[model samples]
Target: MPATYNTDGAEDPDLYAQLMTERYGPLRLILAERNRPAPPRQARANLTPDPRAAEHRHQLLEALNNRPQPDPEPAA
Candidate 1:
């Protein structure tokens, strides 16, 4: 974006005015002079849990309750 002011130390209102006029045109300007707030963010819930989800949760709870185990032996 260009600097909002000119080098001569004047606010470049004319540049933005021209840009808005060209981009939106005068009719749109007359209809709505201001912007509206953006739509709210939407969140979707997980519809179905995985079949193995319960088993995985149980395993996690058991691991948390028990003493820390050594790393498993690497595969051959």
Candidate 2:
């Protein structure tokens, strides 16, 4: 049998949203969240920075810019 909604994969937001809500269920949230009001944001974070963030950033930059990088030293 032919597949239904073969071209209905996110190309058209309206159709995709309908299909998602129907095929999933009323309990399927986030679909209804489309173009809706912004959910409340947290006032502040209780998070700490990862010590390796700098290293990861340098590695990502080098990879994206097509360059090799030396090991990153600890930040002051």
Candidate 3:
């Protein structure tokens, strides 16, 4: 979906405010208004170390080593 922004060059105002309020109802609108940054991406650990902090390190390595399954076809 395309992001909306004010054409009038205003920085502090939300361009999608009215539409978001109508679409998601009021509480979501309030939460959206808070304008928080998105959460950070998760990091993976190096599994080659002798003393592994994770007990399931081998399982994790095995899962990573396996080939990824193909994505399912989209609905018609």
Candidate 4:
């Protein structure tokens, strides 16, 4: 269970800010230019597949096929 603080009807601004900072972290302000637009992306005309893809697949299949099997459990 987490500990909680009771304000006990106290409405002090500094106390509220202190409790808030303790419960959360210090307040942060981020200033950004929302009106700015993002840069355009480049479009590729031709895309070529990797040449060694088939070789990698063959090696992975061979490793899986060559893997040792676990011994079967003895009859209970």
Best by TM-score: 4
lDDT of 3 at 52: 52
Report the CA-based lDDT of candidate 1 relative to the real structure. 0.65
TM-score leaderboard ranking: 4, 2, 1, 3
> Candidate 1 on 12-66: residue-level lDDT in tens?
7677667666766764444454455567875777787799999999999998989
* lDDT per model vs. reference: 0.65, 0.66, 0.62, 0.65
What would the per-residue lDDT of candidate 3 be over residues 1-76, giving only the tens digit for each residue? 1244332554535645555556666654456776777788758776567665475787788888896978999999
State the TM-score for model 1.
Answer: 0.30
Off by over 4 Å in 4: 1-46
Prediction-by-prediction clash tally: 0, 0, 0, 0
lDDT of residue 37 for candidate 3: 75
The number of residue pairs in model 1 that clash at the backbone is 0
How close is each model in CA RMSD to the real structure? 12.0, 16.8, 13.5, 11.6
For residue 59, what is the lDDT in candidate 2?
96
Which of the two candidates, 2 or 4, achieves a greater TM-score against the reference?
4
lDDT of 4: 0.65
